[model samples]
Target: MLPPIPVLADYGISPTHGFLPDVLPLTRLPDPYYNKWEAIAANLQALILSKRLRGVVDRLPVLDTIGLEHDAEWRRAYSLLSFMAHGYIWSGDSPSDRLPPSIAVPLLKISEHLEVPPVATYAAVCLWNFKPLFMDEDIDNLENLATLSTFTGAIDESWFYLVSVAMEARGAPIIPLMLTAIAAAREADAATVTRCLHTFAERLDDLTTLLQRMHESCDPKIFYDRIRPFLAGSKNMADAGLPHGVIYEDGSGKEEYRQYSGGSNAQSSLIQFFDIVLGIEHRPTGEKRGRPQEQGEGHAPAPKHNFLLEMRKYMPGPHARFLNHVQSVANIREFVEEHRDDRPLCIAYDACLAMLRALRDKHIAIVTRYIVLPSKEVRTRSRSRSPEAVRRKINLATASRQQPPGIALDTRGDGKKDSLKGTGGTALISFLKQARDETGEPAVEAWAHRFMSRVIRTEGQGDFFAGKPEEGAGLQVASQTEEAVIPGLAASWTVDDDVGGICYY
Candidate 1:
């Protein structure tokens, strides 16, 4: 059985039943396909190509208001979904598309019966990260996902905006993970599955190894329905969240600190999204100090175990164990210090470490308040957000909220300007170069914009979601519409090196 759901009752939603609308559909598909894959694909393609479907989508502004505009990350995310959607569509009609029973049987094992990273990853990003961002965007459609067979908006409409929020919350760390895993899988699944039985056996063996991870997991739904969607960016989102803990005054208004303090600092609240689990402390040398620096854990490596591990009791076992691993080898400061002198190297490697951690921490903190926490309170606030709302918040957070000299998101690839136009990655690198020259305390706006603009990247056909709205179009993904996949996350804090970055910034 699944674990008991946490806030479902308070929100008046049930996890055990259909995610449907109050208005009933006049028709129903045969039940088997509704419960499985092949049928749904045929239906989706047929529906999408139909005039009626397009008309219905056009008439429903609520469904399309959150179209994924101005983001490449969102575009890539949708592409992955489309890939799966295509797989589902073509498999039944195209014999070659169908997986051999041999592959199917072990895929079940490798994915813990959840299928390829699709359902699990979607559930994680949607529930844990995106829902809070779009909780109040008239997401009645999401509540009625059962009607999607007849609904005609981009498949992303219901969830894309929500994903944006979660992705932003995590500072887009998760997207690379998605790109890494899916690209590798897409590349390898075919190459690794050559027709040889030995190859098949090897694939199965590899899958069996992946299955060892299943015992370590509980239900993805725990994140989807309970803990994840509520991380938001407003006061309500932060009932316990602290967006302004590190504040910077920018003349316009006092803003939440947005400067990159350093990479993955242990002190930032970004590391504490799982505070209950990671047991992150503000202190520099405590029980968590024994291990070497890990990614998500504090930059300083831990020397040995501490009672903070006992605090894991308050967190989900996976989260606690994961933090312990990070706490073990994640201190950027100590790592750089040990590698080089504590004194300034050109960039002051220690500063780089601090900046990286700070960036991660700030991102987590912002995402929680802006995306997750607000999602939990959607019932109370239903007003549509204006274009200025986010921009204003960003400006307020910026040390100089003034727009970049020549970098407006409006010109990106719009064809109005012959220039590269909307390449956010190109622009971020430009800004980083400028900062490298400045050598002064960085501007919050410059760093924030540049940091946020960092393209969610992968080594393959670029961002899988590129051109797809849910993954983002250019570089500026709204927090409500996309999720960055962070792969190899240690769901448990078993204190291992080479694990996922911990709760540290």
Candidate 2:
């Protein structure tokens, strides 16, 4: 039997079971600190509304309020820090990298206690911050995700977090599916492998379909202007306004900045799990200066500091290792290629890649409307005015106003304002382009070549599984390039580097 699917309990929700409300206690702690975190949230919101959130977060003794060290308290503390952190970092004309002690110290402590990254991670914002509308109801419902937040309460934030929640719930089954696929590959059971591949394809298709529903309730304008700001980090965001850095409110009066990317789906562990399991090799989307580094093991290119890859450092330790292990046992593509003679296996693998490609294509289309079009409209409107004309700004006072529910931003060719900043002001374009590039046709096309190309006819048995599993099964899966290096074919990181200059006043 396949080594018992690794326990996913540490991930807050177990992959083995349905997410009944009480099954996971993702709520605030009771008593003094409970009220304390609430008070902190209220104050943070007050500051945000007044546009005075900048340089003032450090004064809040956010950590001193913790009465106990329980998970609930940690959750509460995380919620507070997320609000304060984002506000302190992004409320200014530009984002800040250095976090003040009031926010950073307690945040680091609480995140350690909660076993998550110190930054505004998926765990801090989504996993730990949501509660079901009813005590007995499942949290998978979008309506059930009552976000206990400190910033502007918008449906866009709820929708972004819920999308991940829904994805985790739906993606739970795939963990076992992938594990079984590995076992089948070890047994050299071509039939079993093919069956697993077909199942994986169907699940991926379902996921792609689920992702398309993001537009159903989440308005693009609200998302770009209101929700996206809270999730942005200071790294690669010069265009968004911090050419240098924002000063901290701390009395130390020291300029502080750190190069760190912000919270995005790129940092989602669940998605990374899929990439690892599927052997999807993601190349960098930013340009490099020198010749490619010498090839590492398995013809894998030398590791580079890809912002997406770097986010792995922020994942929960167990989850990060889980990704590494899954990557170690990646065998579906190799197995399918080895059996190219079997048309069914080849077709099944191709179909899976197609679904993955389709998922990226759908995201690109969403970006085109949600980010690109509105941005282009903004740029066009700004251009029509005099060179000295002041660019339009996000009106936080009107942030609470709700858009018409269930309607996506109009994508008609007509040039209408949709509220998203143009490529010059927001990091949305770069982030979206990076995401789109990862899922672009080139990556899938490379896989297509490997799937359709003639299989090498070497009649030699090689040690497939890289390392011995703890189970003592001694079952050899297939050898991947290295631990985590999944190689992609011909793909360029930069489509065009010289797009625009940083937007600063």
Candidate 3:
């Protein structure tokens, strides 16, 4: 028999809140013994600003996980420790290579219990880290949300995080809606499936608007310099340091280096859910694009590690399982493909893909503003400054340690260095462009297939979705390239270019 359709509740998912905790995140752990963790989290900004967070964390006693009694409590504890861990690693002049037992021991246990990695994750920093500003107000309101923790205590930091929080909350309804569409597809009820897909497309447009609102509060400069550093993970971070990742000490005189990607939106189960429900497949970054090979294609290239699949490891355990189960039963894309003669079904399905691709397109535009422009400005500034002056600035920013991860200053030829990688350690621009391009690949309509697949060049700006500019045009390309050059968009850049994807916080 075919597997049963997945229920949101079975995996601790919420109909109202989606992947967010069904109940509000606990403000504090219930046990007084855990107050130490709470105190650190509450004072995290101050501790990080003072550059004394590591010392305080190193002096902490190794706490036991026995006091975490419920799932909410476990989640709260995980968020608390994850914040403290990231702060401890990054607040210092040099990133801490070793995590003391006080943070490492309990963190490992809690992460295992939560089925997430022992590093700061999207769930840690964004999912479980927010508090509604007003008790009676809806959490989905962007203005009503605030982050409980931040490294810089800057409004930009909070805005950067709350954008994702708001997106998750606003996008929550699509969860059950798409699951219903999945069920409708299974039943081969074309009308219900079409209705669901139409609604899905509309909701995705709402998400795109929410994504665009990112600039309303979060300033790109502050986000790039002050906030981005705290979100860097140890993996592929050799340029900023931590070549061996981090060593989580267990107080037994034993040490092991562990590397993990930083908190990323790619870890957000909501985004992945959209892709899975639509049956959108993402290959490993930089993998050649093509149809599946005929009977013998060298065994499918050994099933290379896909970054999107790797991001699943960073999600909460139950959420990860939910995606896996959803993947097993996803049928909307297949149903749409089989019923190509049905114009409404095909249009609805392709509309969903178009909106998703548009959402990614907006993401690319935002990354260009927040990361690409700022890095380019830094590189430009560095070229004019003497080495001693740059060193002094670095010292002032990092308390005399090396430059923080995700903000490297390389003044190479044409300032086209591939210095920036996503917090997940993938090529920043290339990976995003490929992912955005991939989202358009399964389009059911010939027009959509061409619209999403074609890359058009503008006058000195960069490549964008092929289209003519018109006021209020539904499919107008949304790239922002007046003052900054989008890396890898030049005519010389190629499909195999290893240009990076920016860290989507």
Q: Against the unseen true structure, what C-alpha lDDT does each candidate score?
A: 0.26, 0.53, 0.75
| lDDT by residue for model 3 (1-505), tens | 5678888889999998999998888888888998888888888889888888988987899999988888989989988888888888877766788889999999999999999999888999889989998979988889899888777788888888888888899899999998788778778899999999899899899989998998998887787678777777777555445677899997777677888887778899999888888877677667777874331111112223677788889999999999888877777877887899999999998999999999988887786677666656665676676666666432112221334333343446786544344434455556777788888888888998999899855432422655444554423333222222222210011112222234432
lDDT per residue for candidate 1 within 44-121, as digits (tens), equals: 445444423223222322111133232222222232233232222222211121222222222223233222221123
Ranking by TM-score: 3, 2, 1
For model 2, residues 1-505, the per-residue Cα lDDT tens digits are 2333344464443554222222454454566545644565767667776777654655555455446556556566776677777777666543455677677766666767766665676666665666668857655556666666736666666776776666666666777777677677767788887787788778778777777788887786676566666665544344444444334334456646544445655556666666555555555444423443432111122334554466667665556666655555556656665677887777666776666666655665664555444444444455466544433332211111211221213244684423222222233335444444343222224566554333332223343655435452333323221111000000001111112111100
Our model 2 lands, by Cα RMSD against the true structure, at 14.8
RMSD of each: 23.0, 14.8, 6.7
State the TM-score for model 2. 0.69
The residue pairs in collision within model 2 are 464-478
When sorted by lDDT, best at the front, the candidate numbers are 3, 2, 1
